[model samples]
Target: MSNAKRALQTEDLTKIEVFSDPQLSPDGNFYSYVSTKANDKDDYNSQLFVQSLNGDTPVQWTFGDVKNSNLRYSPDGKKAVFQSTRSGLPQLWLLPTEGGEARQLTTFKNGASNPTWSKDGKFIFFHASLDKDDDIQNQKEASKEERQKEQEDKKKQPLIVNRLKYKSDSSGFHDNKRVQLISLNLESNTFTQLTNNDADHGFQDVSPDGKQVLFAANLNENADYELSNDLFLLDLQSKEYKKLTDGNGGYHSASFSPSGDKVVSFGDEYEYAGATLTEIYVFDLASGERTCLSKSWDMQLGDLMIGDTRMGQSETGPVWSKDESSLFFIATDYGATGLYKVSLNKELTTLYKEDNHVFGFSYDQDKEAFVLGISSATNPCDFYYLKNDGTLTKLTKSNDAFLNEVAIAEPETLSVKAEDGKEIQGWLLKPYGFTEGKKYPFVLEIHGGPHAMYGQTFFFEMQLLAAKGYVVLYTNPRGSHGYGQEFVDACRSDYGGGDYKDLMTAVDYVLENYSFIDEDRLGVTGGSYGGFMTNWIVGHTNRFKAAVTQRSISNWLSFYGVSDIGFFFNKWEHGLNLLDDPAKLWEISPLRYAENVETPLLILHGELDFRCPVEQGEQLFITLKHLRKEVEFVRFPGANHELSRSGKPAMRQERLNHICRWFEEYL
Candidate 1:
């Protein structure tokens, strides 16, 4: 195939679309969701669209240059409440379901997000950090002055803050003040602060009756150990709060049942030395008892999924049917992650199973139907509906026009045994217009999280590489979630050992089994922990001809003081404090072995990335340059660790283009 034709066929990365946050109307006549589309500017813009069950052109509920997300329909289905930054900072907005102008609800300088409507539809509750009273502002200014004085006193003073945690990924700099829940009265135009404590409260869900609120909070005095967030209940009538679960381990996503007699939540009781597997639990309010629903079911399919698609585990709680007889949830099992339905009486049945992953879903108990958002290695997310009799119908064809103009590669599932004889799972994508005998250059892509799993989801970077005529191989190694707690925790204190070996084994298996792979022209690249592994791989061996590391940790010694999670992560993974044993930390750092790197490398990072920090990339780039090695550095302005997922749309596109360009030039 000609290069232009090949490019047209394989360059489907720009055409891929993502859909999320599906909400079914109360009457089950309409559904609303957030659909992200790429514009002429090559930037992704999110808008809210509502459509009927009979498949019609969706009515655009929102229009603007800004992104709209987190759409939720009120109980009466007369209006919709969502969080948007269209007015600059993210705040709550109320829009009529029948199509009308949206009105701003909350006004806060810091920001407002995660808006949930009360059961009675009389008030809207949200979380915000707008407690800047006069005394608090004065204290903050005094603290800033003290820090400036300390910095001026020493020529080379280390970066230190009085806060418990130095940095967070998206929102840098930890403040001591707590995050409170506030409810806004629509009629009175007044706000009432709900929880008035110093502790942080989040993941709130209002009960069906609107008389009580279910949420997760850390009530302990020790802020350091606040990682053990637990489920709590707040009485709106009496203005009292009570703990529902013991705060021994972290708990989140507390949702109420249809009858409001029980609450369902997910968290790890104790696994992998407190890493938390995020199993499902159902709490009976009247009996004051909690039952582990996930444990009762066969775990042979693996750990249950929890949380939304953006953060936390990909698995979420089961949505209770209208009558509270059956629960529908999503899980990754039997090689693919899809939606499942579990009967409260004890029978488990698979509702809908597809080749791709189901990120988020909503069910309408009144109609006995559900609207789901599903995606796979080759297909971007799209909307679908499952009827009561098990009939599946496609709702929206958002990418039909884009997909017709671009050639896309299909991903094939591949499995290999690790060095220790454990089974590993992964997928491989061949270049568009691939031939049978011709050998093609290959790239091994690693995923971040050291705890996150790369499942059957459409990834833009992987497709972009395939379009450039490179075979893309990605896998969930030993430390990845979705398998089990023990498997994910195995990488702790052994960052460069088993995980590195598993990746190498995957590479060897592909080269040996696939005849179309070229061994001489090999490249490796990854971000975060994957980036850390790429650095480690290059330092230990010179097999790869080229490498690219994004937001990686080069030297643990420097990272201990720079990155936001440096102090805690170093201890959690290495099991050693920075002050006690700096040597062990250094040994695990990728920069310590930079002398062995001979292959050309490109380091990419975001300047505002506090999670891995730009300094980590700088350390690797500067050290490689000083050692007389070929290296290139690319820094994104005002981007954070989420640059690949939800960062600025233009920047995200540039990042993908840069990675593809580097590989095309070097390999």
Candidate 2:
């Protein structure tokens, strides 16, 4: 037996380092970023680190095993601020750029987060959840003893749900408190509330003159049923505000141009709501004109790229260049995330394009350079600088040791035409140590977010499957981003139709092209929407020998009442409602066809997943048992819908092990 470098092990997940939130200093001489790693507690911990752009060694700024993140630089570059949990709750902490002890800034009950420096650097703006009547000064004046008593005196009672959205998968049950925008004056050490109302304020960019702030909020009297998050600009001194958006759909990530005459952001009109693609929009402040800047540029804007790394940054921007003639943002295109530059003239350019995923990026104004976190199928994320000369330079090597130790399979991009003659984007991964003449088992891996794109990024689970001698095929079928909006919305209200055909066509394309792939010994697995697809696939066809479905939706009718977004999502995606068309929900549900399933199936779910609640899995498991179908169920305790991506280290490892063991026993 020839010994190849060891295949990536599920246990190696503990060694993966996730680098995110790269912030450039005002002088563009140094960059501060956060790196998270698995700790002895079987959980992830994060710390801050900074490195000079001039080839200086990186220095670890914060110590301890706690999570420290959201690092931001002040305008003058004299000091920085971040959020930390060293005090038991996340609070603002300030550290001098010249090196000194970090000092605590705000001590609030809900804690301060998303802190940004004011233009003059005289104050900091942040957002925090507060009771409608809670006063900031009152909490600051209370003694430590009083704080302890207040905490102990509070009673633990049953949750009373009143709002249509009472619980979230991440925050659990809600307190009915609103998230308000806040500003803290550094010189006076005083706190001022910027927003006070029933609706939650989605923070956006602060004006250049520091006299006004922009944000998105749905302040309508009937916010629960409303679908619009209008953009607003609030004057700091006058306490007056004006609405910018016309309130058609949801808007987010609004950033001011350098001239402050226009604001650039991304949002959707919600004409398709669930299936609608997010587009870039520019709102002119002087003319009160709101234009869909990306209306013609159909590829979804912002990050829809998914990978196995934990605690990655969200896709947000339209950050204006120093001249304000152009905006740089993240766009999902052709199965990868790339940094794109769009001019006010509507000419687009791919400043940095490659078969890699860029989860975060920030432009350095002083140096006129860009700092990006890019990674490929075999590489974890690390910082890279796109120089003024259009050259790329690696900035960090956080995963070099683990990368050098493991043998990961590199994916080959494949394109196949669907029945409708539309091209489907896909990738084929040969088994690790693949021999040209050897026939090996293959797995069809499906991605979630019928809207989320499967791109060139390191997915540990796919690598693990390849290491175990299974060639894997994954794709961005219809209803996936990175493609044109028409291609993405084509799968809406037709979940089991064209999208299913697209996957089958991709499998057929690989089978016809790759002779080494074992056609008779095939396996399939996916989570979330992919989980729903797996369930739908098994019930509709028996081609695969085995399958694993995770956190899936089985019955749309039951989902309508149970899942977090079921009430509206069912209508928006399937064009069906429980009250209006019960038959339609059952017609599209995978559980409706469970009797046809012949593949040995494994079901996985998170117990605390409020998005696609565990009951979805329990129902399918019971139905399969009643039918005496070959099936097994595994439930992860204290895990949410993000179990595969950001769950506990042990749980995520077990999930991978379960999938591998199931396919090994059956395939």
Task: Judging by TM-score against the true structure, name the best candidate.
Answer: 2
- Angstrom error of the Cα, residue 497, model 2: value is 0.6
- What's the TM-score of every candidate structure? 0.90, 0.97
Question: What is model 1's C-alpha RMSD?
Answer: 4.9
In order, what lDDT does every prediction score?
0.77, 0.88
Off by over 4 Å in 1: 1-16, 38-44, 132-160, 273-275, 296-315, 345-347
Model 1, 1-667: lDDT tens per residue? 3233435322344455667778888899888888776566655667888999899988887877667888778889999888887866677899988767899886665557788888888888888774534121111222445556754875475556766665688667655556778788888877777776766679468888888888787777786645677888899889898898887776776689878998877676554543446566778899998877666543323223221123212224567877777777777653466777777665788888876777777788877888877776656767789898989999998777765556667888888899998778988989877888999999999988787777677676777788878999998888777666567788998999999999999999999999899999999999999899999999999999999898888988888778877777777787887887888888899999989999889998999999899999998999999999989999999899888777666777778778877887878
- Number of backbone-clashing residue pairs for each candidate, in the order shown: 4, 0
In model 2, the runs with Cα more than 4 Å from the true position are 1-4, 140-156, 314-316
Which stretch of 10 consecutive residues in model 2 shows the poorest summed lDDT? 138-147
